[model samples]
Target: MSKRLAQRADSRETEIAAVAADALEGRVPAGSLVCGDPDGVVEAALGGPVWNRYAYDGRPAQPWPPEGAFPGAVLRQPRGWGAFAMTLHALAARLPEGAPLWIYGGNDEGVTSIPKRLEGLFGEPETLAIKRRARVLELRRTGAPARGGLEDWREVVSVGDAELVSYPGLFAHGRLDPGTELLLGALPKIYADQSVLDFGCGAGVIAHTVRRRVPEGRLTLLDMDSVALHAARQNVPDAAHVLSDGWSAVPAKRDFDLILSNPPLHRGKEEDFGALEALVRGAKDRLKPRGALIAVVQRSAGVGKLFASVLKNVEALAETPQYQVWRGGV
Candidate 1:
């Protein structure tokens, strides 16, 4: 491993990535494919041009798979089991017989059992490396017939009277979460011609619900995950979509009359409030003069104070034992 990777392996956030980098030390070839490289460690360690695909828009790589064949491929395990399975199936279908495939992840991410899962299609994974509580395994593609794609994971979820098409890996994938349900029930009256923005729209449930109330209104759905954006497109076809991290992809001049969300608070397995904090702090700039930001969150998150710090007329719209709906006006 390079000196930089050696240092990264000791860090909590990039330990798995460093392990992946170390495992591929002398094996990576030019034009290799890499997926789910959240920290770009694998690509940087490869030291060559690579075709990379990332689900989150935060990465500079393509969101969808690129066209072409590769000599080898590396996949950094994702947090969601369904996403991992779907990606594995897709890679199995794409790779040619005998092509090397490397998979790596932290122990906490279920990496230890991956060998059993790889036995059928890849013939059996060879243990490559284990360090820093992370493991890397290598296998050769057997070219076995792969079963499904994104469409196979599609589920039609019913939220109240609205039916939404969702797929695996999205937040609240096959059903509505209680927080969003409460927010929906307590939604304020919206004008027919008002413009609305659904921040962190997972599968378009919130946007779809609001769309029914405002047929003449302009709707924009924003999310960081391409998979969630894909489902949002299908669920609310008429609405505009923006694949962004926080408010990065939103146009500065584009202000909305209302913004709604059940914003994400977790990054992988760790509780993260960065996105939520950014949304609250930046909502004032993104909203029109009379606009308001309405959202539902855990009652214990203490988000009401954060909202009051940056926005005016902040109040709790509704509350349940586990959740609270808050509205902050510009």
Candidate 2:
């Protein structure tokens, strides 16, 4: 896309958000709604692009959200009516009626359900134009407004002897991701104070685990999505982070003591393996002599072939019914 066209597109996303914001001009929404999506449009417009949902998405990239805490002012919750409870609680605190309640997402992500959910929360919703994948909703105050607090969607999910508290859009929320499990199980012993890199750390499972096991090790994480990177920071404290597409920003000559990743396959219409290949090509050069590249992938994805061709030595181990754990060392 041309620079001017891209700027206009970004501007249009804001315009789309304004439609719903205006709909609630009279009162803060008693409830809110968000879909299972990563479309940057909703938060981008409502509050500015301060919130990122695409980070650590099922991809290997760097983490870029600044390491910090965000105001709970903008409440984030799960899909469906649960979001209503959190949104209502936010409104109850300070944002008043006509404060303009909002719900956002793409069409494919079930933004259409926002209108229906709003019908139950406040009243029928007023919808704006449909975009590529989402929609927005604004509720009228004439409808019933029940008191709702944050308790609506809070739940504990099991993650390998751990109970993780989650609300919405947290990867495999309330539970552990399969790929993450594989990566965790494959972690090799590394000395403390060594620089370790999480190539595509998502939800920070690997990064957090590494931090606990090797607190002295300088942990550096990378991911593609802004939201995932943000979540990673929250999940894995004290680790250095970068946001980019799978070590794309790291110089080819830069070396690391260890690299871990679960490479992503889907890229739009085609499944691009470039990230994995790039990892293999640069990993050898980047490693500290005997540094390792640990990764996991589905057996059907034929990760073994790539590992064999890329590393000085490749070891394949079975983690689960579907995953193959591959570790390459120089």
Identify the candidate with maximal lDDT. Answer: 1
* Model 2 RMSD in angstroms: 8.0
Tens digits of lDDT, candidate 2, 65-174: 22332222232223345444444443433333444444544354356665555434445656644554445555444334544333354555666766444554445655
Candidate 1 runs further than 4 Å off: 1-11, 47-63
lDDT of 1 by residue, 102-190 (tens): 99987887888787676367868888999988889898988677754567667888766788887667787777789999999989988
Q: Give the lDDT of residue 251 in candidate 2.
A: 72
Candidate 2, lDDT over the whole model: 0.57
Give the TM-score of each candidate. Answer: 0.90, 0.59
